[model samples]
Target: MKLRSLLFVPGDRPERFPKAVATGADALILDLEDSVVPERKPEARAAVRAWIEAPREDGPAVFVRVNPIDSDEVAADLEALAGLSLDGVVLPKAEGAESVAMLLDRLPGDYLVLPVASETPAAVFQLGTFAGVAGRLAGVTWGAEDLPASIGAATAREDDGSYTDPYRVVRALTLFGAHAAGVPAIETVFPDFRNLDALAAYAARGQRDGFTGMLAIHPTQVSVINDAFTPSEAEIAHAKAVIAAFDANPGAGALQLDGKMIDAPHLKSARRLLALVG
Candidate 1:
């Protein structure tokens, strides 16, 4: 499924659910974890369940961000979601493939999973293990907010909101790990929703670095995320040209395109870009 933008909605606030769905996001994550206070967990869970069970026509695919696997509430979270139709679950703070396995074990049948694979320090080392669970994963995403707090860092971002070296490494690992896992590497939320320009730049950077999608904390970011990820007409045209060049010169291993050498790798990328648009 195309998840160029996955917008987050606080699970306790069912009044905002319809508004979130109407934001034109490709998917909506009803967050039952971080957004809910401990005292309101039960109420949030009930609200999410009711929303999921409510009759509605096809719109943005809905996913729930359950609490961490190690949390005491996880079992009840899984139990509450039993048999409810959902697009997927955003598994947070996943330490390893074992975490995914444990979640699958409790769930009744096959369900798409999008794991936040880099939230804790230990989770950084376990990123590679995601490849083993690719069959069940819709995509793999990473977060900068939790990791800094987990490691007791004062801040994960610089004054300009760019990640520092340490967090940069984590982001790269998440990207490469998702590639290794044969799934989309969704970029984490930009956090500063008010600065549309910064958000656009951040999303553009993610796209340039091979991220297929991005997470959004607010609805205002959905359009920016989607626009950034979507291939422009110029890009599509160039990709088509590259493919045509290779096809026209089948016997040649390399060809010239726009005054640059187009090789097998370029051809592969062109095909992949076209496939994404399709």
Candidate 2:
């Protein structure tokens, strides 16, 4: 799937589901975790189940963000999703391969899993181990929200809303870890949805830094995320030119393209860019 954007809709708000789907996000996550209060978890689960089971021919693929594996409500979350057609599950606060494997074991059928690889202090260290479970994973992502509270820190981000040094390290680890696992590195959400310019910059930076997609907290951010990740027509044309240079050169190790020397690595990058459109 082309997952340039994955928008989150609170599972309790079924009314918002169609609206979220209409946002043109590549996928929609019916969130049953942090978005739902503890008292309404059961109700949220039922709502998500009904939405997933309903008939819908067109829209983005649907995924659900279940509570943490250790939470008392997780089992019920999984049970409620049984026999439903879901594209995946966004496993928040995921630690390592073991936790992911446990969740996979409980799920009834083949389901893509996108683990939020960094949340707790320990999870920061376990990012590298995700390669072991890459086959079942759709991708890997990270978030800065819960970590500060977990460690009793004042905040995870600076006054500018950018991540602090530690959180930056966490983001880097998640990015590199997903690449090491051979999965797309999905960047975390930008909490300040009101700042569209900043959000666009952040999404552009993610694409430049090798993130294949980004999580969205609000539906309004979806278009910006999608546009940032998607290759423009000019980019596609340039990529085709690069590939054509290599093709024409036959066995040549390097070639000149518009006065610049192009090599094997450049060809690889061009091919990857073109693949995004496909």
Candidate 3:
């Protein structure tokens, strides 16, 4: 899936399913977890399955956020989704590869998985295990909201709206872990839907910091995230130039590009940037 922006829609709100698709996000996550109340989960699950079974042409890639793997509610969530056609499952509070495998076992098909890798405290230390389940992954992501609540923190962020030192570490770990697993590093959502300017800056920072994509809580955030992640004309031209230079000088360790020495790492980054567009 081209996961530049994955927008979340409450599974209970079936009416908004098409609305989310119309936003032109790369993927739509029909949330069965936090978004739906306990009493309405069954109804929401049924609603999500109904939408998936209908087969809308040219719709965005669809994913369902099942209950956390450790929750008893997950059984019903997976049972309700048996044999459904969807892009992936968003596994919350994932501690390691075993969590991914557990979800995979109940699931009927080889669906892509986007694991929220740093929710529980123990999960922080378990990010490295994702490589074992890399083949089953769409990407790896982290959640700030649940993590703070899990640990009884006042907030995951400081007064400035930036993540505090600990959450910052968690975010960095998740980013590297995703790359270690050879998947896209997806940044968590910026919940302030009303602040377009801040959202633009935040998304741009994510792209600059090596996150290939980001999560979107609201539809309006989609275009901003897309634009932030999209390679600019200058970026595309430079990437193409790097590739051309590398092609012209096969096996060269260092090449001069725009008066700067470029090496293997630079070539790798250029290729990755181009891969995002193609």
Q: Taking the tens digit of each residue's C-alpha lDDT, what string does model 3 give over 1-278?
A: 78999999999999999999999899999999999999999999999999999968887889999999889799999998899988899999999898999899989797999999999999999998899999999999999999999889999987778999999999999999999999999999998999999999999999999999999999999999999999999999998999999999999999999999999998999999999999
TM-score of each: 0.98, 0.98, 0.98
Model 3 scores worst on lDDT over the 10 consecutive residues at: 53-62
Candidate 3 residues lying further than 4 Å off, grouped into runs, are none
lDDT of 2 at 195: 95
Model 3: lDDT equals: 0.94
Model 1 regions lying over 4 Å from their true place:
none
TM-score of 2: 0.98
How many clashes does the backbone of model 1 have? 0
Q: Taking the tens digit of each residue's C-alpha lDDT, what string does model 2 give over 41-124?
A: 999999999988888878898899999999899999999999888899999989977779989999879999999888888999
Which of the two candidates, 1 or 3, achieves a greater lDDT against the reference? Answer: 3
Give RMSD to native, each candidate. Answer: 0.9, 1.0, 0.9
Estimate candidate 1's alpha-carbon lDDT, on a 0 to 1 scale: 0.92
* Residue-level lDDT tens digits of model 1 in 218-252: 98999999999999999999999999998898878
Looking at candidate 1, the ten consecutive residues that score lowest on lDDT are 102-111
| Highest-lDDT candidate | 3
